[model samples]
Target: MKEICIVEFTSNLGLKEPQTGKEPGVNRLPDWLWKHNLHKSINPKNIIRVDPPKYSNIKDPETNILNADSLVTYSREQAYLINNLLSANKFPFVLGGDCSILLGVAMALKQKGNYGLFYLDGHTDFMDISLSETGGVGGMAASIVTGNGHEKLTNILNLSPYIKEENLWCIGNREYDDEYENEIRKSSATYISLQELRKQGIANCTKKFLSEIQNKNLDGFWLHIDVDVLNDEIMPCVDSRTPDGLTYDEFNELTSYLFQSQKLSGLEITILDPDLDKTGEYTKDFVNNLTSTFNKHFNN
Candidate 1:
């Protein structure tokens, strides 16, 4: 039986376009999820929440990344917390403030040894600071995790290139800026775009991805899901949105396959903006789908 630990990351400091004036409700996800009976479905006793981190408005002049200093500090702290949970043999369900939290998660996993990454998002997130218009760490998460971004953020915990390029597999990516697309083409990471995902079928494509990971003989792998990957009609509460993403059924199917693989060590859900979910419909749907799917696969 897998022991699950719910870790809430409430820092949006890495976002280039800071949510000012109004409430940045992404940080309140843990509360919203809990209020919506997420704990009841996933076992309330198993849930554990990490204290929210502080955010800063300062941006690094050289790197153009927002809150670079604070980001590094909080990332290490988040990593420490995650590492402790891993040591206790707990499967972490990290609810994120943004994709930048993947940096901290990667840092935690790197301490144990080489691990693969299953990046499931709408955007590739491989943009470097130079090309990134917002300078949000979230945009450069994949690049930072692979040791291809600014030195300070990429070298967190001295684990430069936290995860190897060859070990990373990106799926469900549909939004690719020109520079990001070029970078993806040059990257060693395995990428299966949403278009191709439809062509080959999610199951067959995932099977192939898992085979490659197994061939690499990795210790374990992390799953990163950015909510923007879901269809705009179904999930429209993210910081950024694009048309024609995966349907709820398709996403559920894909996550089910991943959880059943037994190689998944940790998971993070990012980019859901509660401020945009005024009717609470999106949040409710997300909680329902995620909790039901997670319970079906990991419930002991």
Candidate 2:
């Protein structure tokens, strides 16, 4: 039996405004919306709600405590929990606060050395503090995992660098500029654009990605999916919305393919804002889609 654990990331400091043309500006997610409903959707039976320690200094207009540079602090506690669970071989299914929560997951899985990462997002999220055009720490998740950015996060989990560039791969990116793209090129990581997915088809892209992971002889890996990767038509409730993203069907195809690999040791879903998710439509769709895919892939 595969036991599952859910890590809730309820911080927005790392996240700034969603800059996509559809929704341009700094946007804060609603308070504890997903946290409340996740149990019913996933019904993990062993769900672990990880509320990261919040900082009291910033004037948070969003009501919820915005834990900023302090994410590394909460990540430490998360690492302990994840490490213990993984020791028993449980499948971790983490929920949003922001994409930055990846720091903790990366740390906890550090012992699975030479692990591969499949990062699915609309943005590269490779910006460093100095290069961050928006200064949103959430945009720097990839960088933090690759051993860049503030020492606090890169150094979290007591691992000098949680992941190596070669071990990382990014899929489905359509929102980034030359500067950030140049930085991404500097890393040994590989990536495919949304246009490429459309051109070649999701099945081909997914098969290629899985083949690459297999070729690497990776013992373990993590799947990080930012909700913004879905086109607004189907998933409009995300904190960030991109117009030219994957259709729900395309996303399902790719996710279903990858999940079947079972090389996926964990799954991270981030950036869903319940405040904007009226009628729980997006939540229900996301829950149903992912759960269905999980059921199909694992044949549960």
What lDDT does the true structure give each of the candidates? 0.82, 0.71
Q: How many collisions per candidate?
A: 0, 4
The regions of model 2 sitting more than 4 angstroms off are 17-41, 55-69
Ten-residue stretch with the least lDDT total in model 2: 21-30
Q: What's the TM-score of each model vs. the native? A: 0.94, 0.85
Cα error of candidate 1 at position 179, Å: 2.8
lDDT tens digits by residue: candidate 1, 1-300: 667888888867767544454434677767777777777777733665555456555578977887888788888988898888888778888888888888888998898788999999998888767787777888789888999977899998789888898888878888755656778778898877899899989999888877877887887789999999999999998877899999999999999888877778889988888778877888888889988887887643
* Model 2 / residue 144 / CA error / Å: 1.0
Residue runs of model 1 more than 4 Å from their true location after superposition: 18-23, 51-53
Candidate 2 lDDT, tens digit per residue, 122-209? Answer: 8888876667545556778887788875565677646957887777878888875677677777778886778877888888877777
The clash number for model 2 is 4
